[model samples]
Target: MENNRVKKQPPKKNLWKPEEDLILKKYVEAHGEGNWATVSQKSGLKRGGKSCRLRWKNYLRPNIKRGRMSQEEEDLIIRMHKLLGNRWSLIAGRLPGRTDNEVKNYWNTHLNKISPLGKRKHVDSNDQNNTNSTETTNKKSKIHTYPVISIDAQKNPTKESNGKKEEGSTSLLNPLMTDTKSFSYDTESPFIATNTSTFFFDDEPLITYMDSFALFEGFGYTTGENYAELGMQLVSP
Candidate 1:
């Protein structure tokens, strides 16, 4: 009975060849975009209209930027992401020569990992928990916290009076070092530094510290009483 109920699977999609690609490209070039259904039928390709449309828009489109995104493009993507969320098509419109699929892929592969807002949302979602003793105990036992540090390299390192490289000086602290920008130490051990200039701190300790500082600043509390109250709230059961 189980074997009889099993459904037959569909055949695999045909792998597009260079000649098929050329035919599709020439068809679109001669006729111009749209009418993909007709193009698919007339081009003699086994792929569907949607597939042809995506191939043309994402790969065959003229002036499409194919390399790694520039700093400016990355910044724009970050800002646009914040404003528009995951509306990739809308975001792609703001970035000239970039396709929606490219922007979406970049965000998923790269930006999402480094995005502070994304991390904060993830942390907040995970932080929401019941206050029951058993639940709290289970959550706390499972939680693995690690130290995170953010280090900002001074834009200009102090130079030697003699204008000569100091003996035994490394580039990590060298003022003249032009490549490294900023770096972060995270939950992962042995943090690897990069050639960027901005650093982000995503650890719970840093977030707690920032929250406390903000609360203190907002309340304009200069007295020990306020500090005591704040400390109590932070440690309260």
Candidate 2:
């Protein structure tokens, strides 16, 4: 008897084209990345979401700042790689503008090559540990050496002076006194006390002397045929 089981075929590669990369770079330069599906459709590229995103992040976008790494940058990469352990996304965050794929490719191509040159006498836990102990050993062995620089760290050196000036400008230290003529500062108004003290509340809607005076003096709404009614209609619910 013959067997009829079939082997599964591999998926087709989503190769990045030069023109596609150029279009992605241009569009991203104009409108920043992240909306990959919409971007691909707009750019007329046949690439999928993941592929388009990877292409733009890893290859395109200006100020990429690739090539030979500085000693400080390299040190950060080494420390991050050890701490994060092949977590390209996490490691890439430590180095601005650098992609996970770029970091991974650099680690595989460059770092691995140079790692042997500066190899210490100590055994690499990754190589020495058994499969079960590997994860635990690797976790404890790798240590982060550098202090991660942040936005606050790299903020304006004169920020303290600016902040001090800003704090001084606010009424935090010195309190303000409000005038009572145009503005009222009373905790209990005379009108409020008069209303609560007297049991007689006018059924004809008693207008305050100040309010009537304000209307008479044209400081408030002028008496008209339908000014109040018109005003009421204009106000939203």
Candidate 3:
């Protein structure tokens, strides 16, 4: 049996109207925020609950710090990002009124260009170093296990001519997986194992984010003069 996997396409973005925003804002104001499904239903807005929640939280929500991220916020984001890579919600938790989406967008737009990980490199066997590690997240005391990216391939990759595959070859059209390659993950992170010499996924999402995660024994940032400990972080205002 040939099993064909369907790729999930992102939902089409529908712009929110002024009236819709007004209704969502008023409803949230009157009833506090929670139960997004109820808000989507009771508000009579033809939008998904996720959409309604994001709209309210990102735009309609009160006390959202907007217009120009402060120097302090940028520094905090950088420090926090160093401690926690691509975990936007955890990074945003340190910043008041800043949602994960907003933080991610800002990083992708502005900070990414300036950071070391932003530098583009040719997708080759060397990139395999970045993709070949299992991530472990330890928050509080509980240990969360991430998918182990296990790929066994040499520096040199085999090339395919005329884009032709053998009759008994796999269904996946990607020629990058010429050798033994299997990329599967149960978690949300969509990783594909490939011989990096020929091709690979975008470095920003999987390669840099995963490879850039350089953590010590615990959470905190350090410099020659000052070592800021984790106890001082997320201090309530």
Each prediction's TM-score versus the true structure:
0.45, 0.42, 0.52
- How much is 135 displaced in model 1, in angstroms? 31
Candidate lDDT (C-alpha), each: 0.51, 0.44, 0.51
lDDT of 3 by residue, 1-237 (tens): 455676676666688989999999998898878899888889888888899999988888876878888887887777666556666765665566777889988877888667544543442445434431123232432233223323232221112344232221111111232333222222212122212211122212332232222242122212211222322211111
**What tens digits encode model 2's per-residue C-alpha lDDT throughout 98-160?**
677788777767785665433434445466432221013344433432222111111111223
Error of 3 at 216 (Å): 4.2
What candidate 1 gets wrong by more than 4 Å, as runs, is 1-15, 116-237
lDDT of 1 by residue, 1-237 (tens): 559767877667666678888888998998988988888788787778998999888888787778999887787677556433565665575565778999998987788767444342233435454221111234343332322222232322222354332221111211333332222222212111223221222222333323322333333533334434322111111
Clash pairs for candidate 2: none
lDDT at residue 93 of model 3 (Cα atoms): 51
Whole-model alpha-carbon lDDT for candidate 2: 0.44
lDDT of 3 at 197: 16
Stretch of 10 with least lDDT, candidate 2: 165-174
Q: Cα RMSD to native, each candidate? A: 18.6, 27.9, 21.5
